[model samples]
Target: MESASLDSRFSKPMLDGNRSAGSLEESVSPKPLPVDDSPSAPPKPPNGGFVAWMQVAGSWCLMFNCWGIVNSYGVFQTYYENEMLVYRTSSEIAWIGSIQAFLLLFIGALTGPLYDSGYFRLLLATGTFLMCLGMMMISICTELWQFVLAQGIVVGLGAGCLFIPSVAVLPLYFSSHLAFSIGVAGSGSGVGGIIYSIAFQQLQKSIGFGWASRVMGFISLVTLVFPLLIMRVRSSNPKQKRKVRKLFDSSALRELPFCLFLVWGFFGFAGVYMPLYYVGSYAIETKIMPPALAFYLIPILNAGSVIGRTVPNYAADKTGSLNMFIPTCFGLAVLSFAWIGIHNTPGLIVFIVLYGIFIGAFMTLPFSAVVKLSPHLGVIGVRMGMLCVICSFGILIGTPVGGAVLRQGGWISLQSFGGAALMVSTIFIIATRVAKVGAHPRQKV
Candidate 1:
């Protein structure tokens, strides 16, 4: 009876001391175990392996067909304004491209939720069908609404559907080296722009507009199949039904760093495509380069982008994605400013190459940066979707607004606008970095 009473008295104080220790542990010291490595912890990505790389290859094909064609829109914009849709004002014509840009970012709002809920194949098949169908439809379009409906709305929706999964799914297979892999995959966009731009320029001259677009449709159909066959999600809860109410992650908005980066993307994209859209025309306007040579500027830019996309991403794996991204944004801003003063072919070519390099790096680094900021792989889709949806507004208005300025104030004014937007965007990126890791130069961000 005396031993039992003594045990009971010691147990109560021991429990109290343990409770105090727990509080002190949280307050003053690191836990013995990592929170992320507990039994109910999230599944880890493979980081790198054969299947992971094949996933990258598949994603490459999708990006090639989706963003690739969008990047080539400058070629189309110039073509329609000069020959096909000559009856329309530049601002009116700008709306078609704007709508296309808007959908590319905007449709992620729906697709992101679907992807996270395990609807990968359904989204992929549907996207393939719509994108191919839209391209074929573009061939037959001779009217403005037809272009807007087919190219802007149909193609944009298809591309957006294809894009979200490719970007979101791949990151699930990689925790480290994500920037490099994504950069390599994204290089397809540059390659696709080069192929489509050259094909459109040559084919339209040889076979006519209708056939050129059909040929592009056929190419997209072929390339997109590879991705559809190989891509999938590595789900931690494959059998669990996704909550309908949880489709969007509202908590992401509370992250000041993520929001700052989103704003950075917003204002950055506002002028990102301006050079691609207007460089060819600018060349023709200055009469410095022959029309034939002027037509090559977009291709030149895209060619340089191929290198820019791959190389910076490799470097970003080490120096930090946002670290590299900030300087590139500044470089792009300077390039936009300088593009306005180039009245000679050599200078134009130099500008195009530099612009391609910086923009390629700009496009390549941001996605990986977003991935770095996410706490869970499952939430990646939602976060990326939201960023795209938010940035879509900037891309939507960018070309139309720039085109309007072009119509009213000439090339100098448009250049200034593009440059200003980029400069402002760089400031936001710096703010994002500050919020993330503070001002320590050695910090990886």
Candidate 2:
């Protein structure tokens, strides 16, 4: 179904000496065991060990502080409307989040290339500083423009720097279990969502808006330290000089599966951000749930995601990432469609929980799938950056588009647009699978 040359080109180059005995796939055995390598060469991943597990934990905390806070934007969306920026139109306020989401992914264009050049500590340290600083700045901001600068652009840029490296490092640690490791780290987003949303809600009531944000900033500062100490580049070629380049990976763009997957991410994000940014407002506007319960909807959805992110990825290792991805994409589309018809409280609850689970799985698998198609593990950071850059445009516009549609045609129009984007994305997802492993059901792609 796909080009034969692409398969041959995908294999890794063998190192000199004993490493020349096997292919890269052979080097990555099914079990999580350490590989033997030359002392002068780069480090081989242990796959599973106290040191390796600690790396994953550090990455988890980074993801929690970065994307986790972004995932919880729905809580902010609701609060902006009801209290803080009450005078602003929904579309105006929505821009803050759209810009935040956009920059978080867009800046990967630069950070990804930097990460590939062995600047792990610099990226992680700089990102943590900017993110914490942004949060503290948000505490004192009272204007829309100030929020835009502090929360949207600064925080978003920090997140991109931290998120790309945190994810890229996992492939270096676990080849056989890459998907499961990514899922575990990615699950931090769900945990952060639950914790931050709850904290934002309770703290707003007790200490007011400014101090609530400052408290969260303080917590992020504390959590960020673990990653700084434990996470590091494998440093296999200790003496290799780093090369600087523009963020784009021109070579990766020529590959068919890679091209197809980027198309899928572009449309997929158009739908993905809709629920994460609007579910809180939807519950309140529909009046199916009370204000108190509606506020907790994001947390409830995130709670389900914690389970969804971890369990499906374990299955994905056995069944293949693309195999699991198709169903998750379908589920996201169906849920978007279903949201329009939901009227009762119980139905809303059920829908949110299912939405959380499916979307979590939907977002987690693509990283593993993309890495599998990559021609060189060394450039995985650049390839991932390119994908995120393409995906960034869709995220940039997703919330604002939804807000505009909601204003003009109400929830039905908004949900219909989201559902349509997701359904269209599935075609690309399937096409990518066909390109990778053809139509065979039994193949592990």
Rate residue 376 of model 1 by lDDT. Answer: 32
Overall local distance difference test of candidate 1: 0.78
Instruction: Report per-prediction Cα RMSD to one decimal.
Output: 9.2, 4.0
Q: What is the lDDT of residue 359 in candidate 2?
A: 81
lDDT of 1 by residue, 1-445 (tens): 1323332221111011233323322322222211233232335666678888999998888888788888888888888877899898777788887888789878866776677566888889988999999999999999999999999999999998988777766656765556777888899999998998999899999999999999999999999888877777765544545433234566677888888988887899898989888887777777887767778888889999999999998887667777888899999999999987888878889999999998899887877677556543334456666777778999899989999999999999999999999999999998988888888877665
Per-residue lDDT of candidate 2, residues 1-445 (tens digit): 2324332232221222233223334432221212235455444556689877888898899888887898888898899988889898787898998898889888867776577566889998898899999989999999999999999998998888898777877766665566788889989989998999999988988999999999989988899988998887675565755455445656676778788899999999987778777877888877877677888988988888988899999897777778888889988998999988888889988998999999889768777676566654434555667888888898888778888988898889999999999998998999988887689888776
Query: TM-score, each model?
Result: 0.88, 0.90
- Evaluate residue 105 in candidate 2 and report its C-alpha lDDT on the 0 to 100 scale: 83
CA lDDT, candidate 2, residue 203: 92
Candidates' C-alpha lDDT:
0.78, 0.79
